[model samples]
Target: MSAIFNFQSLLIVILLLTCSCAYIQSLAPSLLDRNKIGLLGIFWKCAGIGE
Candidate 1:
């Protein structure tokens, strides 16, 4: 009984991780663009490149 319960818990954790990863993966493109803009903004400010 304990073993079965443990197995079910592990399965639930795995499923949750998989689903969350997929959701994040779908957002990867937008996230990357946002990060790129953020980095560029930082560089422009630090180096006065944009000004």
Candidate 2:
């Protein structure tokens, strides 16, 4: 039960993170490009959206 709850929370966190990253990418491509951010860049690249 506790494990399930933790998993759900982790999943929600990941979803939120992904959505926020997408929003940021849409809003500020230059910032993300210039800084070469790590996790978000990896996520977008894996999603086949980013370079």
Candidate 3:
């Protein structure tokens, strides 16, 4: 039961992320362009979500 629930939850997350990325990319493409920050800026990257 736990395994099945986990699989279903993961699938839902995958679908949501797919839709979110597509919508975000089309709406404001600049928001996703954080690669320039490099590995050291991962903390700040996550903080951006709050904004």
Which structure among the candidates has the greatest TM-score?
A: 2
Off by over 4 Å in 2: 1-5, 37-51
TM-scores for all predictions = 0.45, 0.58, 0.51
In model 2, the worst 10-residue window by lDDT is 42-51
> In order, how many clashes per candidate?
0, 0, 0
Off by over 4 Å in 3: 1-5, 36-51
2 versus 3: better lDDT goes to = 2
lDDT of 1 by residue, 1-51 (tens): 453479887777656655654455455535423443564444323222212
Q: Please give the CA lDDT of all the candidate structures.
A: 0.47, 0.59, 0.56
Q: What is the C-alpha lDDT profile of model 2 across 1-51, one tens digit per residue?
A: 553479887777666667766677788766556545676466555223422
Worst 10 residues of 1 by lDDT: 42-51
Model 2 scores what on Cα lDDT? Answer: 0.59
Candidate 2 has what TM-score? 0.58
Tens digits of lDDT, candidate 3, 1-51: 453479887777656656666566567756666543877344334434434
Q: Which candidate, 2 or 3, would have the higher TM-score against the true structure? A: 2
Off by over 4 Å in 1: 1-5, 29-51
